[model samples]
Target: MSDKGLFISFEGIDGSGKSTQARLLADHLRDAGRDVILTREPGGSPGAEEIRALVLQGDPDRWSAETEILLFTAARRDHLERTIRPALAAGKVVICDRFADSTRMYQGLSRGDLRGVVDRLHDLMIGVEPDLTILIDMDPTEGLSRALSRKGAEERFEDFGEDLQKAMRAGFLALADEFADRFRVVDGARAVDDVASDVRAVADGFLPKRRV
Candidate 1:
């Protein structure tokens, strides 16, 4: 590890249980006597949280793919400045629920072929990737079912329907292959504790040995 603490991100199609896994990992790390901060993307900082409302709780057609990319990038910049960077610099493990990889899929590929745009914006503004990215892979159909059952206002993306979810799952898997060094794929179709165990093991391999 660098003088800075480790950074880990959990990603998956909607309702794949990545969020639950992220929290569990944070708890586990803290129990093991490591400093940890659990945060989420598009809403980590005050400013970003406002933007998150704009982007996540509107019509599916609320913004063009390009506009959404810009919004996500702006929110991410704020999140990094206000939350992720400081935590990592202070030697606290940063566990993020979602990060730029979501942008690389949702806005980058879902609507059009704008991945290059996403990558360029990310490099220019938020030029950081998680030290470890745990992708909780799941079947898109089931994932969508789980997502819609939540009946939350943040279902704008889920409103895009099963097609988008399928695309997202494939896109996430592809990202895992593309950034294989930092990405770890874990099955998320089992019981919560079982999935959490897999996530914990994957994270444990990346985390440095705890200081005694």
Candidate 2:
């Protein structure tokens, strides 16, 4: 990790507006003259993109819980090596829409254990933890409804019933409690600008003496 760069990740269940908030934070930082790189997990690199498509679009029956976790970690490893790490090394703040936290929530909801997966990936990736992680917390049912209302299609995970989404949201909250110092939970049900302002506040607190 470069001393001059800050790594921030935005995480939440579907339709919690993580992508929007991530872009807003990156724009705020860039306008303040900080070099910024906005990216997403399960992607951000060629190899990772392929893995993303496979995981998101492939046959649901073909992927077990353990296999899903491994695939996510594999994509994350590539993303870190090819994109996130290099950007941070160059002193650019990196804003990722989702990172290792998603794996913990999604896989933990499905498989019931994420400690081994998280530990193994952290070791292999050489401690690429985010300086700040903003989780846009919301009711899973509401979030999923929003997601389905906005996007007409569903991926393998999104295809899961509402109960699964609720489980995932609970998993996220549990993980946030486990990493309270590094995680911030935002009210995702608020208006876009309100949520954006909250995100800006959290990010500005970690940035190098800047304003949003």
lDDT of 2 by residue, 1-212 (tens): 35567899999998788999999988988898999999998899999998988887745566877878888888998898899888888889999999888887777455567667666766776466798999999898888887777754336676776887888788888889999989999999989999999899988887776555
lDDT, candidate 1, 1-212, per-residue tens: 42489999989999898999999999999998999999998889999999999999978999999999999999999999998888888999999999999999999999999999999999999889989999999999999999999999998999999999999999999999999999999999999999888888888888878667
Distance from true position, residue 121, model 2, in Å?
3.6
Which lDDT values do the candidates have, in the order given?
A: 0.93, 0.83
Task: Report the lDDT of model 1 for residue 55.
Answer: 96
Q: What lDDT is obtained when candidate 1 is compared to the true structure?
A: 0.93
lDDT: which candidate is best? 1
**Model 2 clashes, total count:** 0
- Residue 29 error, candidate 1, Å: 0.8
Worst 10 residues of 1 by lDDT: 1-10
Distance from true position, residue 47, model 1, in Å?
Answer: 0.3
Query: Which candidate leads in TM-score?
Result: 1
Q: List the residue pairs that clash in candidate 1.
A: none
